[model samples]
Target: MKKPQRSTAIFLLILSALLLVAMATFFYLKTQRQSAKTSPTKPALTVSTAALEQSLLPQRLSANGAIWPWQEAVIGSEAGGLRLTEVRVNVGDQVRKGQILATFAIESVQAEVAQAQASLAEAQANALDAAGNAEKARSLQRSGALSEQQINQFQTAEKTASARMLSARAMLEVQQVKLKQTRLLAPDDGVISARNATLGAVVGAGSELFRMIRGGRLEWRAEVTSSELSRIKTGMSVNLLAANGLPIKGKVRMIAPTVDPQTRLALVYVDLPLQAGAPNDPAAIRAGMFASGEFEMGKTMGLTAAQQSVLVRDGFSYVYTLGEDGHARQLKVQTGRRFGERIEIREGLAPGAVLVTSGAGFLNDGDLVRVVNPPMPPTASTAANPVPTKPQP
Candidate 1:
């Protein structure tokens, strides 16, 4: 009985030991599996990156404007209460300085001039008679044949006749001036932009007859914000887009001293060339035509990146900056003018920063990325098939 009991105890102990070994093996395998699942794997995305560099970029200011004449001449009538007899020039007619534009009725003015001439003739005859009488009176005064008062009266009569003759001559000169004014002449060489004078219409003095574009020159009036007005100066080159979609070159002529109260903008006057190149080629630009243009302020050193490196999201521009830990950090940036394939980085980016050039759109902030140097393509023979290895004996 004692031997059987001892064997039973030994078997129980051996079974307990085996159970402990099995439990330990199970827990070890479970821990190994949990650790394998928790460990992270490297990102699978391959991306290209570029280093930001400082480059000389052109600074430009853009604005919308209207084309206008450099100097608009308001041609009006100088003669009052005159009936227009002939309208020679109409709108769009090219005229020279002092060229006759219109004509007024000259019959009444010619009659007045004739009447003045007759009055002057009568006055001159009277003056001649007075001179002879005065000379006789002087001679009689010395001969004691005339009293002093009578001689004085003769001298006074001669003076009065001479004054009347002078007045009549002045009246004739006045009438001649009126006759010359019967024709309206262009003040300068220009193209007629507007005309209001009509045949048989009675026009008053200072009434507008025609509007001329002096020298046939046009200008671009650009409206710029108050902040940008200071950067513009005279002689700056501007590029204006014409209505015909052709680019017209212009130079800054003047800048308005005061800003418009309502729009809070200032006007920049740019002079357009009279002729683009040909004599017969009409000016491509016209007044009152809306234009869009840019002012080339100058060039400056700026940090720029390729257009692909930058991404726009959430109404803000962003770029993926390569991090030292093999990850991409999303950064916000302020952008400026764009030139060709590159964009100006105005703010939020530093020089010498590595930026992701490709696959930036698929990245998030602090996203792991695999940097890749693209491999060259294989040769045609290599791409066709692999060379079989020799069998070693």
Candidate 2:
């Protein structure tokens, strides 16, 4: 019985030793599997990078604006009559100062002028006869051939006839002058912006018949908010972008002294330059068209970057600065006016600071990033010969 029990104990010890070896192997395999799963298989992604550049950016302001004329004139008829003649001028027609535009039928006016001349001649004759009668009466009275009462009566009759003829003559002259106003003439050298009078149309006195923009000097009336008033001034340079995307040069002519009570906006006037080749081209710029004006406050000192460098979500403008731990950090920044391809950064970034210029749209705040080409400091030699340095360097 003692031999059997010893054998059983030896078997149990061997079994315990085998179980320990198996447990150690399983743990080693588990550790190997975990390490393999944690390791990344793909190569790191690289992105193109550029060094922060220092340059002078413009301090400017942009506002919603529109085009307007320097002075607008509404042409109308001076006298009321049926339109009989339109002498060549129409919409978009360039006219000189005092050039006849249209005419009304006033056939009776010609007759009235002739009648006035005849009446004037008759008045002259009557005045001569009255003077002669008065002289004769005086002579007769001096010779005692006429009584004082009779002489006075003759003098009064002659004076009454002379006054009647003078009154008739004056009435005739007024009628003749009114006839000359039948013709419509251009008040100044300008283009006819609109026309309301047509052939055979009757227009009343002081009725609008044509609208002309005087001198062809067009201007833009831009609406600006009260807060943006100080950023603009008279004679400051501006660039106007039309709806058609054409750029035209202009200068601020006036700033509104008072703000509109309702809209809190001021109308800023800017004079647009005439096209050198064709100053009178009507199709060049039409009034009442919407436009945008860029007020360039000149170049600013400090950092300026491409518009894509800014991340705008909701109302805040921000940028992503890559952290040392390969994570992106969000930074709020103040922005200034926008140029064609770039915008001015007012705050939140310093020179030599690195940022994500592109691919920011795909990144989230604090996301890990693999900078393809890291930003490098400019070596003394590289700074001296920047043109020869490799693009990525």
Candidate 3:
């Protein structure tokens, strides 16, 4: 009985001590919860801020079009029914005016010319004999050596022979022209764009043999909307890029007087310079290549922001500005032409707005932010379009 009484007292004391320790732990946890609730929030990102700048930015109109020849010259054979004997030039060959491009078998033409020449020579001989006989008859007009009727006949024969000789000489000239036509000649200075002449094949007159870009000159026909047409003018500077990404500078040569009814687009003709190399230089832009370009419509005053500050999301332009409470507030902006390091802010932003110039992508709306001074700008030679940035805080 004495041992049982002592064990029960020890168990009761242990339970009371455990209860006190549980109460103390509950109070300590409550105090820690309160302290956590009162603690200050940490900044989510650190970014450089910039004031909205008003600058003179270039007004540009973007357009797309195709490059074409100023004029394409078609070269063909003028003489008919001749076998192609030789092809001197293929497509893309640079040729000067009157350059021989192809030749036909001259055997038939030469034979005909030889026949005509023989005929002409025979006519000349007959004419000389007739003239001599007529002169002799005239000299003997009063002499009894010739009858009057015979003398008249001789005179008439001389006139007929002379006329026949003239006819034969004209026929010879015709044959000579046909003989020269056996060779195909380039009509202009240009680069051959196509060739259709085939060796050993008989072709007729006026059959196209080759196509050339006359003068190696190319023009870009840019399509612009009707509203945008007013902004483009003759002599305005244009910067163009070919499909191969080569940059070319051009000037507006002409603008169409009317727009296409179906597309409501007008053509602006831009003349490209003679590329400084071979006409068919692989590096040079050629006719029929599509291109994109911008027209410099001069300068206009507008609000601008650092190019890096503009963010694009879901095809919408956005920028983050600092709020009075030191939190990031996102604002959608309308972006216009980009010039160098600045982008035109057409709308959705007011002047004097402080924009997060860097690391806005890592931020969320209402997230605390810390602003810092921008680092020194990199030199042009070593700089990229948009400087690399990172969140600092």
Give TM per candidate: 0.72, 0.72, 0.77
Off by over 4 Å in 1: 1-49, 242-246, 261-263, 276-283, 320-331, 356-393
lDDT by residue (12-119, candidate 2, tens digit) is: 999999999999999999999998899844422333334455677777678777667678789887766546565567887778998988888887777877888888
Residue pairs in collision within model 1: none
* Model 3 pairs whose backbones collide: none
lDDT of 1 by residue, 260-288 (tens): 99999999999888874222466466677
Which residue pairs show backbone clashes in model 2? 46-372, 47-372, 57-300
Who is ahead in TM-score, 2 or 3? Answer: 3
Residue 248 deviation, candidate 1, in Å?
Answer: 3.6
Whole-model lDDT values for every prediction: 0.89, 0.78, 0.90
What overall lDDT, based on C-alpha atoms, would model 3 receive against the true structure? Answer: 0.90
TM-score of 3: 0.77
Best by TM-score: 3
Q: Which of 1 and 3 is ahead in lDDT?
A: 3
Cα RMSD for candidates in order: 8.4, 5.9, 8.3
